[model samples]
Target: MKIIAISNQKGGVAKTTTCLNLAAYISKKKKVLLIDCDKQANLTKNLGMEGAKTSINDLFLKRKFDVVNVRKNLDLIPSSVDFVGIDLLIQGELARESILKKALDRLESNYDFVFIDCPPDMNLVTVNALTASNYVIIPVQATQFSMDGVNIMIDFIGGIRESINPKLNLLGILVTHFDKRLKISKSIEQDFKDNNWEMALFKTRIRRNTAIENSQHKDYRMTIFEYDNQSKGALDYSNLAKEILKLIKNLN
Candidate 1:
C-alpha cells in the first residue's frame, strides 16, 4: 500500500479537505484507508463519526486500533481529542516516533492507499505520521502566511528525513483555496513558480468554493462530492485525484 500523509503546519490550508476528498475519490477504484492523526478529529467529525470509541489515541496508548468502515472500500482509524495529551505519554518511550509506523505495519497490506491527516504542528503526532508515510502531499493555501508555513514545513520535513524516515518522499505541493480572480492568489502561484520546488507542484489548484465549507456545516458532515458533485469544489478534487494517480504511476 502507498501510505501518503497530507500535511501542512498551518491550519485551514485544506489539509483535511484534501485528505477526505482524495481518499473518497480514490476509494471508488481502490481500497483506501484514512488515518486521522489530528487531535482535533476534524476528519472524523466531518465524516459524521464523532464519537469513535477507538481512535488513533488507543493505537498509541494501547498499541491496538479498531478499524471502522464508514463506507464501502473506505476504512478509517478515527481520531479523538484525547490524543492532544499523547505527547506526554510518548515522551521517554522507546522508539516513540515509530509508534504509528509499527501500528500501521499491521494493516498496510489491506488497502491500496492510506492517507494520514496530520495535525497542524510539528509535534510528536505529526512525527508519527511522517514516520509511517512513504510519501507526503503538502497543501499550500494561496496566502502569505500559508506560503511562509510551506517554507517552515520544508525544513521540518528535512529534519524528519535526516533523523527518522530517510525514505519518505515529498509527493507534491498542492495549491488549495486558489482564486484566479484574486490578485494575491495569482501572486502566490507566481511565487511557487519561481521557488525551487524539489518535488512536483501540482497543476490542479483547488479553487475557492463555498460548497467546500458548507460540507461541514450540514446536518451530517459530508464531502464535496456528496454535497454537490457538479460544484467547482467537487470537480477540482476529482481532477486532483486523477492527477495524483497519474503522478504516482509515473513515479513508479
Candidate 2:
C-alpha cells in the first residue's frame, strides 16, 4: 500500500480537508485508510466519529485499536483530543520516530492507499507521520505566509528523509482557497512560476467556494462529491485524484 501524508506546518491550509476529500474520492474505486494524526481531531469530528473508542492515540500508545469503516472501501483511524499531551508521553519511548511506522506494519494489508492527516506543527507526531509515509502532499493557501510555511515544511521533510525515511518523496504542493479574481492569489500563482516551483506544484488548484465550506459543516458533514458533485470544489478534487494516481503510477 502507498501511504501519503497531508501536512502543512500552518493551519487553515486545507490539510484535513484535502485528506478527507481525497481519500473519499480515491476510495470510490480503491480501498483507502485515513489516520487522523491531529490533536484537534478536526478530521474525526468532521466525519462525525468523535465518540469512537479507538483512536490514533491508542496506536501511538501501543494500545489495542481498531479502524472504523466510515464509507464503502474507506476506513478511518480517528484522532482524540487527548492526543494533545501524547507527545510528552511518547517522548520517553524507544524509537519514538518510528512508532507510527511500527504500528502500521502490524495492520492488515487491505488498503490501496493510506492518507495521514498531520497536525499543523512540526512536533514529534508529525515526525512519526513522515517516517511512516511514502509520500507527502503539502497544501498551501495563496498567501506569502503560506509560501513561507511551504519552504519550512520542505526543509523539515528533507531532514526527515535524510534521517528517517529516505524513500519519502514530496508528491506535490497543492494550492487551496485559490481565487483568480484576487490580486494576491494571482500574485502568489505568479510567484510560484517565477520560483520554478511548477515542477513541484500540482496543476489543479482548489478554488475558494462556499459550497466546500458548507459541505464540512457539522449539520452536513458531507464529502464534496456527496454534497455537490457538479461544484467546482468537487471537480478540482476529482481532477486531483486523477493527477495523483497518474503521478504515483509513473513513480512506481
Candidate 2 per-residue C-alpha lDDT over 1-252 given as tens digits, one digit per residue, 9 for 90 to 100:
999999998898999999999999999999999999998999998899997999997888975679999999999999988899787899998899998898788775888999999999999999999999999999988753456667789999999999999999999999999888888888876777776777898989889988889999999999999999999999999999999999999999
Candidate 2 CA-lDDT value = 0.91
Candidate 2: list runs displaced more than 4 Å.
Answer: 143-145
Best by TM-score: 2
Specify the poorest-scoring 10-residue window by lDDT in model 2. 142-151
> Native-vs-model 1 lDDT?
0.88
Superposition error at 22 for model 2 (Å): 0.4
Predicted structure 2: clash tally:
0
List per-candidate RMSD values in Å.
Answer: 1.3, 1.2
